[model samples]
Target: MKGNKGLIFLSLMPWLCMEADAAQHWADTSAGVRWSSSFREPYNPEKVSKTILNVTHVSQDDYGRNFLFMDYYISGMEDPSKDNATGAEEFYGLYRRTLSYNALAKDPIDSSWVKDVHLSGRMDVGYENTQLSPRPFKVRMGGLVDFKIPKGSLEWGLEGVYQKSYNGITHRHFEFDPSFVTWMSWNYPVTKKSQFSGILEYLEAIGEDGFGNDTKPLTIFRANYIYDIGQPKGFKVGVGYEQFNNKYSSNNAADPTNGSDQKTFVLLGSYHF
Candidate 1:
């Protein structure tokens, strides 16, 4: 039953992405596909594979900026001998739209720096169905403030998001909490075909409901080296790593003893059209 539902949703994604728009108000729209596989060893060794298709459209108007984004994911492998009856281990869908306004819209001096200091808010809704969890609708409401320093290449911003879950299994009940994230990145050109960029982010989640014990604070650091293949609109590749740690208590019985020390390496390739 689950496999059949996943198949039906996957088939409808392309049409939704292509025909959902009635008014052509966005500046540009882009679509892409991605695939990733991971291997992990935490007392038990396992492998996970995922494929995703995404589409995004953004438009800017006198009032603010608007964006529409959608994602579909399919996981696990297909093999009759390897517990093939389950089909895939996970499948999920996410759809979100956001609107932001700039307060210093007409300012001339330091226009770029001034505009980043704007008041913005957004709402997001998503659905997920996986072998480990049942289907649920999730919603997030958030606000952000972006600002940059003058006379320097330094920029910074802060944002807070609160999320809640509805219509899910016992363990996947509704939880409302806020998270704060701050990020900094720098861009440097090393020759015309290559560039180096670095980023750092800190995130903290406030607990709510009985699920509070499972929440944690995390910090992520990333550095990337990008090389242009040939043309202006060609291909690029990147490599990075991510590390995770738990900051809050755990509600799951199995996770407390295991600790939440996890890490992953990432490799990426993409083309622009």
Candidate 2:
């Protein structure tokens, strides 16, 4: 049944990422592991032949910026008698509450046009075993904006998420009204220490997941190019690119979500304290 519940939640994904890093007590943290493959093209598992394990935590004082992450997906060619993978693993978190980056850095100071803002929220959970839509849960209540990029070393941002969805039991959709995803992220430098981060998204789930099945408009993109191994509590290395276009996807065993496209590329490294 859905590959025995995705092999019992992928064997509790390393004790749930070490109990979410002991309930986030490590403060500003970053732990990583990623290994991707697809040399010479021709790899496909819907578009990923993966291996990844990540854990991240970030913080900001004045109660206005927090991030948490957990990811674990292993199945470059697992079999377990078939059905690919069950609940690969994805856990996320976000919280922003800067109330305006200390009032836009104390009195405008030459209006370069707002370079800080906040009030963001997000929570995600995904577990899979796969028989067409294994498990999903998302909650995002957002609002974030940052601008004022002037000359190199950029780090732009924007977001507006408002999606609340929960489904499983091989859903099919029918719960309308409640899906809005807008995203933008950046990190451009390409010089001192090298840089080139990325993220782009646009999603609006068109309701239908209880067996009525439906989903069409979706877009996702990613880019990467990192370099900086000058430790002292920072180390990076990257080369990534990702793409997703969903005509609809439930696993696409025929027409689950009606795939539109899929792409992948990766080779990244990280270390941050």
Candidate 3:
């Protein structure tokens, strides 16, 4: 079903990134793999292991910048995928376009703290091969305030979007609602060989879910301190702390222990090219 679509998109990502690199002023792409065994299953209280393969691309053109990332998740057999009847696999991706006010303005504002402002458009798409076989799609429109930092930068942004979701169990009968999201991201150099970076995002819940359960707000937070290994940008490794409360906006009424909350440490590695 949706997994087929996700597979096609993920397979073509490399080619798309290469084309964008040739057409953009500046472009960079990174491939990273991460794994964790501390994740919990929703509704059912049990620990499961998950591995993720992530590919990210960022490019700047005459107008502004483009950013995209795709994640492929493989879970243990305890949560088997519908397609394979074994481990579950999910694909999720996000694409963002930032139209810079400074780049288009006649006279750009040069304030001390505010580096630039941007009107941003974002799209999120995801598909999972679990029993539910959820397909979620959303489009966001918002603005971002970019601030300058010593040898680095930070971005604070907000988005308002409508979510349209379909699942195998509920089909298309579930209620769709609009949600507001706020996020912050920053990266700073701790030393020449080390850097601190992370992202914090909060999503306001919409209406009821597929099961008619009242959806809850979602919070995702990740902070990492990465150290460069060999060359300047060749190989890197880091450890990070991650937290997810009310993940996927699912309110675990069946499991009163809040089995959905995930606060764990993750090991990360990446290569930039």
CA lDDT, every model vs. true structure: 0.49, 0.55, 0.81
Candidate structures ordered by TM-score, highest first: 3, 1, 2
**lDDT pick, better of 2 and 3:** 3
Q: List, residue by residue over 35-150, the lDDT tens digit for candidate 1.
A: 55652212223444555566656555534445566666655553111244543433344443333344224553356454343333444555445332434333333434444443
What are the per-residue Cα lDDT tens digits for candidate 2 across 183-227? Answer: 777777878887788878777765664566565556778888888
TM-scores for all predictions: 0.59, 0.29, 0.88
Shift in Å, residue 158, candidate 2? 6.5
- Lowest summed lDDT window (length 10), candidate 3: 14-23
Model 3's number of clashes is 0
The number of the candidate with the highest lDDT is 3
Where model 3 places Cα greater than 4 Å from the true spot, the runs are 1-23, 173-175, 252-254
Candidate 2: segments with Cα more than 4 A from true spot: 1-106, 109-114, 118-143, 147-178, 182-184, 192-195, 200-204, 208-212, 216-219, 224-240, 245-261, 265-273
Candidate 3 pairs with clashing backbones:
none
